[model samples]
Target chain A: MIVDIHHLNFAYRDSEILKKIDFTVKPGELLAILGPNGVGKTTLLKCLNGMHRASAGTVMVEGVDILKMRPMEIATKIGYVSQKNEKARLTLFDAVLMGRKPHIRWRPSDRDLKIVEATIRHLHLQEMSLRFIDQLSGGELQKVCIARALVQEPKLLLLDEPTSALDLKNQVEIMLLLRHVVDYHHIGAIMTMHDLNKAMRYADSVLMLKDGKVFSHLHPSLVTEQMIESVYGLPVEIHNINGHPMIVPKDSTQNLCC
Target chain B: MHLHDGQIPEEYRKYIGRKFVFLLLLCVSLLIALLFSISSGAAHISLTDVVSSLIGLETSKKIEIIVWNIRLPQAISAMVAGAGLALSGAVMQSILRNPLGSPFTLGIAHAAAFGAALGVMVLGGGIMTSNSMGAVQITNPYLTTVAAFFFSIATAAVIVAIARMRGTTPEVMVLTGVALGSFFTAATMLLQFFANDVQLAAMVFWTFGDTARASWSELAVMSIVVTITGIYFFCNSWNYNAIDAGEETAKGLGVRVERVRAVGMLLASVLTATIIGFLGIIGFAGLVVPHIVRRIIGSDNRFLLPGSFIGGALMLLTSDTVARLILAPHVLPVSVLTAFIGAPVFLILILRGGRK
Candidate 1:
């Protein structure tokens, strides 16, 4: 197991965000987490990245407890891409170059530059590299962010709503790029998304959460409509499209009405 | 859109040329400062007289007194305060990650003002009746200056501590500084009110800032402090670059976020403290010079810090020269002159920058 979570529980202030969340991921696999908003989707990713200190649980990555590792150590191992779409002061090259941050001190090294350049090349971000990050369209910025994380050269990649800011085509491209990262780089990925159909289409496995508890952990075939309906608190219709499950609205107007 | 091209051709060229221009500008400003500091003062000393007096030529005692006792030290103080404030402003902006961050924002200047008020009112009155600004110790001049420095430093330290404990939000940090500044200003006001007639005059005069005290001894300490700090900050300001990338990015880059931030603020604040104690609160030089430099130099602390220092020193000298000769025998306080010039210029810069 690349990551093993034993009874993870998390809270902020007086409210619990995650409860007894047990799951695991294998090496070089793409695991897409699906859940309603505010259901520990981002929180789970934070837990995996060691960004959040869990209230009660052990997260073991590669047979070592992630909690025991320092944040820099964890950062070196897992590159995390957050949802900060715009911090305009940073240029594209600098934003991407920041991925090398975990590998060096406050100053950038020659090696750091080489990695940043290579990552930029790999993502075909050579054109937008100098543009300020805020000036870029959402899709371009998302790609730039991914390139930044890729430059970290981490074995595990964590993304929170990587496609949330993107349009449909951009969403497809980001997913495809993520897929490339998993397959070509041999990096384990666990990303959270709200698009169930997209998740089913792209992810090798699925982790579903309902009210902070793990609803189920399964492959695309086993992630039943009933399971999603229960977790999402609404009636969801699932249809098979070329062997992948596409979830749809029971009532198009309201959020998955039960 | 891409990373391969790196800095655009213009920025790369700018990165090099700006440094040269900065150096050239620094030299020109220094010469300008030296010329005006020597030429323009209360006494009608000829340029030749100022030069002769400076190089130990046989000049009259009047020329000698104006140059050596009056204008020379004042010039040195202006140079030191300007450079010190600007450099600290650059550091503060970087550390705070806000464009508006400055030494004045942190309450160090206000604290220093209050300390000077105290020193002039309590210490000077109780000891030196014929005392004046920069009038060294019949008692401990250094002690009085240091007391001012430490009071400001302590206030800054408290602000830093509170901000760090509360998660270092920009809003919280800035608001904290604002609150401290108010507290210090109120205290200074209270001191000014309670002071005796002679003491009141001294306190009021000091608040207006006469750099007449920038004696060779004070300049000696200023150089030492400024040099040590300049070198130390030139080395450490890269952490500003890292943190400016974003706090988490800085942390990922192995910058202990809390430690670096606290250290940066403290260093900048301490420099402000030391400077204002000797120079007596030269206002707006710190705030304006750094802001202008940022427009040309960009926000990278490596570039911004040193650039602002030179820019600031130049501004101070020029302003002081104008203040001195503009009023002839009645010398206007340096702070009033800086406010007059700097405020308008800063307003215009901000207005133009806002358009962008």
Candidate 2:
């Protein structure tokens, strides 16, 4: 297992956001966290990466408990890509090189620059590496952000709504890239997602969150229509197309004209 | 395009090399400005004479005295104070994540002004003069400077404390700073209302912010503070760059966002307070220079911080020299010149879309 999270609890003052969340991710696995808004999906990802301190429980990456590690140490073990990134007037090359912050003290070594260069080329961003981040398109920016995370050389990756803002074509491209990254890098990835069909199609495992608690953690093939309806509080129909499960709202076709 | 053994591309190398060239050009420009400022004063000393005087070559005694005692101190003070203020402004903008963040906008300058007024009025630091102009002399410069530093840091502390309690979002910090600025300005006015003519004149004069007010010892102190603070900002340039990306992203990248923000505010505040205490409230340089530098060098703090330092020194030195020689034998306040040039340029930058 790449990550073993058990009995995780988080709270903001008196109100608890995550309660006794338990899950594990194996190497080369893609776990998609699915839920409606305000269900603590983002919060759970934050806890796993030590961005937020868990009130209780252990997040064991490999063997050591990451909760006890400093933020720099945890960053070396897990890379995180936020949902919203500001458009900064920085070159794509420099922005990707910043992922070496945890490992660099005064300046980036030759090895660090080499890693950044390789990561950018690997993600096909060499052509625009000199361009400013603020001038990049949405899909290109998202890819650059992902490239930044990949250069961290982490054992696990966490992304909060990685494709929540992209068009359909860009979304598929990002998902395919992420899938390839997990397989090629042999690293585990956990990302919060809103699109059920995309999650079902790409995720090796789906973890549904409702009311700040885990509703179900199972393979996408094992997730039933009843589970989706119960977690989302909306009627959904499951359809299998080309061996991939597709989720559609029950009345989705009836409102096509509207 | 493929990396065989982790080699950086030549194109990227050239791109990075260009920013370094820009930095080198700024340094060269600052040197020229410094020489011009030293050469052009009320005294008609030539640039060759100024260079000779600086190198301790056999120059005229009178020229040496004028260059070393008067123009050199004032010119160096302008450079040091401008560098300090601009560095502070750059860090302030980065940590607060606001384009408008600066010592003047965040009320640290106003707080220092109020503290100086209080020092003159209530701290027995002002001496009543018999001149018809009613010019009041600061009998104790240390008392006034200490007072100004105290109030300025107090204002920063309040802002940082509020940010700590209510979250270090840019909106919260900037709003709090604006509120404190208004409060301090009002308090200064209230003190002036009850002051005698001499005290009122002294208080009013202090707010004009002339770099010529500093002597050699004071210049030494300002240089030390600027050097120390500049080094601190440079060392933490990566942290500032991370914060520029956004607070959550910084935290995820192993940056302690809150700590960096609080400490950065305190240090930048100290830098601003030191300059304001010595030279009064030199407006616009702190607020406008960083924006101008960002437009030229981009927002990489590693380059931006040093770039602002050199850019600021050049701007202030050139402005001070022009203000000194514009009317020749009668010096306009450096703050007035900066505001006159900074305001129009700032407006143009805004209209041109300030950051690239």
Candidate 3:
């Protein structure tokens, strides 16, 4: 398993955010965490990457408990991309090179530069490598963020709403890029997504969070309309189109929970 | 998304040539400023005379006293204070992510002033008459410096504490700093209200920030402190660059975000404290020089730090020379000329709206 979480619990002050969450991910698999706005999806992602401490559980990345590890130690093994994109003033090359901080000694080695160059090329950002990041568009900046994470060369990748700021075409392109990189690099990826259809199409498995608990954790093929409706508190129908699950929300008032 | 398919600038690719050229230019400019400052003083010493004296060629007795005893210490003190303040300003701006973040804006200057007042009251042997600048001469310079250093660090601690509680956002940090600065200013004013004439005169003179008071011994101590702190800042240049991207991103890149910020504040505070403790409050060097350097060379701290150091030295040395020569035989406070230049630049920064 590339990532293993057991009986994980988290709270902010007195109110609990995540409760008894348990899951495991294998290498080369893409796991999409799906939930409503306040269901603790982003918070859960923060916990797995050690940005937030788990209240009562353990997160193991590559068979080592992350709770016992320092932030720098966890960062070496798990690359994380945040939800909000900043207009960084660094050149794209330096921005990506920043990811090599954990590996750098006094200065960047030739090997480190080579890795950053390769990662930038892999992201198809060679043309803009010397440009300032603030000059890039939202989609380009998102790619830069991902490129920075990729340069870390982690065993597991965590992304929070990676496609939130993108348009539809950019969204699909980014998801495809993530899938391609995860497959080629053979690294496990866990991303929180708001688009249910995209998750159903691209993720190897789906984890649904509802009211700070796991509503359903299973393959996308096994997801049912009742499960979706139960978690979202809205009526929805699932249709199989070209071997992919697509959710269509039902228009009804009486079935809504009181 | 690229606007041009033009080849990346060769210098950009290598990361050595342009930066080297810029640094070289800054060094050359500093040397010119040093020579200009040393030669253009009231004594009317020729460049040859100044050069000979600097190289220990045994000039006349009057030339030696003017160049070695008075001018050299003042000129070098200006350079050291400029470099230290500008470097600290750049570091503070980066760590706080605020363009307005500097020793003055962060309350460190006012805090140091208050401490100086405390020092004057204690070391000047109580209520002093305002008639004489030398009447309240501090019995122990170290006492005043230590007091100033303590208060400056204390101010930084308060700002950091406020940041920690309210979140280390740029707005929060800047607001807390402004508030703390105002409070310290008010506190210093209260001290001045209660001060005797001599102590009041001493307090006022200390705040004028003249480089003439820097003796060789004091310069030696200031040099050691600046060197140690400057090297530490240079070594962590990459980490600072990472943090500039954003805190979460820096943490994701394996930087200890909170720890780095705290240490950065500590180092920057110490640098500002040591300089201000010796030279009094030299405002705007830290604030203005870094901004100018950032506009010219860009915001990469690796280049920005050295660039600010040299640029700052040049500005202060030039400004001090102007202050000395603008009126012969009597020197205006260096801070007067600095603020004359700095206030306008600060207003321009606000009007231009370039800073993020």
Candidate 4:
């Protein structure tokens, strides 16, 4: 297992955000965290990456508890892509080069530059390597951010709502790219996603959260429409479309036009 | 645009190289401004004479005295002070993530002014002269400087403490700084109101921010402070770059964002206080020069910090020279000229949307 969480709990002052969350991710597995807005999906990812301290329980990544590690140590073990990527005047090359921050002191070495270059090319970001980040399209910027995380060479990767803002084509492109990266790099990835069909299509396992508790943790093929309706408080129909299970609102009219 | 077998691309190399060239140009411009400033004073010393004296050549004693004792210290003061203020401004803007962030905007300058007023008014540092002009002078420069440094640092401490308690968000810091700046300004006005004519004159004089007030020893102190603080800033340039990306992103990259913001602000405050303590609030260089440099070199602090430093030195030296020559034998305060130049340029930047 690349990551193991047991009875994880998080709170902010008076309100508990994540309660007794438990899950494990194996190497080369992609886990999609699905939940409604404000269900602590983002907070759970933050806790796993050591950005937010968990109130209770252990997040064991390869047998080491991340809660006990410093941010720098955890950064070497897990890469994180934030939900909101800020637009700055920095070049794509330098922005991705910043992922080597935890490993290098004072100046980036030749090896670090090589790794950044390889990652950029691997993500097909070489064409815009010199372009400023503020000038890039949303999909290109998202790819640049993913390329940055990949250069960290982490054993685990965490992304918060990685595709919540992209269009359909970009969303599928990002999900496919992520799927390839997780499989090819032999790394564990846990991403918080709102698109249930995308999760069903690409995720090896899905962890659904509701009311600060886990509703279900199972393979996407095993997720039932009843469980989705119970968690989302809306009736949904699970349809197998193109050999993948997709969720559709049960209230939609089946035949509309003449 | 393919990478050459995992090698860094040549286009990226050229991009980095272009920023370096811009920085080098700034340095060259600073040197030219320095020589021009030294050569254009009332003594009619030529650039050749200035260069000769600078290199220890056989210049005349009178020319040497004027250059070494008068022009050189004032010019160097402008250089070091300008560099320090601009460095502080660059760090402030990066850490606070606000283009309006600077020591002057954040209340450190006003705090120093109030401290100087206190020293002149209550600390027995002001001399009340009975001459026809009713001249007032700071009889004890050390006392005033120490007081100024103390108050400026006290203000910084308060801001940092508030950041620690509340959080190091840009809105919190900037708002607290604006509130404190108004409070300090009001307090200084109150002090000026109760002061006698000599003390009032001395307090007002100290606020004008004349570079000519700094002697050789004072210039040396400013140089040491600026050098040490500027080096500290450059060492953490990458951290500033991360913070510019976003606090959460910086944290994910293993940067202690809160600690960096607090420390960067405190150090930048110290840099500002030291310069203001000696030179007396040279405005707009801290606030405007960083924006100017950012426009030319982009927001990479690795280049922006040094670029601002050199650009600031050039600006102040040139301003001081113009201030001197505009009214020969009677030097205008450099702060006035900095505002005159900085305000219009800043407006243009704002109108242009502050694009790089």
Query: Candidate 1 lDDT, tens digit per residue, B67-146?
Result: 88777888878888888888888877777877778867777788887777777766663234454543323234565577
> All candidates' lDDT scores?
0.77, 0.89, 0.84, 0.89
Off by over 4 Å in 2: A252-258, B1-5, B128-136, B348-356
TM-score of each: 0.84, 0.96, 0.92, 0.95
Off by over 4 Å in 3: A240-243, A253-258, B1-11, B122-142, B162-172, B343-356
lDDT of 4 by residue, B230-266 (tens): 8999999989998887788888888899998999999
Highest lDDT among the candidates is held by which one?
A: 2
lDDT of 1 by residue, A167-194 (tens): 9999999999999888887778899988
Candidate 3 C-alpha lDDT tens digits along A1-258: 999999999999999999999999999999999999999999999899888889999999989998898777888898989887567567888888788788887877666777777777777888898888989988998999888888787899999998988999899989999998889889999999999999988899999999999888899989999998888888898888887788998868556655
Evaluation by lDDT, superior candidate among 1 and 4: 4
Q: How well is each residue in A10-95 modelled by candidate 4, as lDDT tens digits?
A: 99997999999999999999999998989999999999988889999999999999899899888888988888888888999999
Q: After superposition, how far is residue B239 of candidate 2 from its true place, in Å?
A: 0.8
Model 2, A238: alpha-carbon shift in Å? 0.5
For model 3 the TM-score comes to 0.92
The reply for model 4, stretches above 4 Å from the true place, is A252-258, B1-5, B128-136, B346-356
Per-candidate DockQ values are: 0.23, 0.59, 0.38, 0.51
Clashing pairs in 1: A125-B2, A126-B2, A127-B2, A128-B1, A128-B2, A129-B1, A129-B2, A129-B3, B134-B213
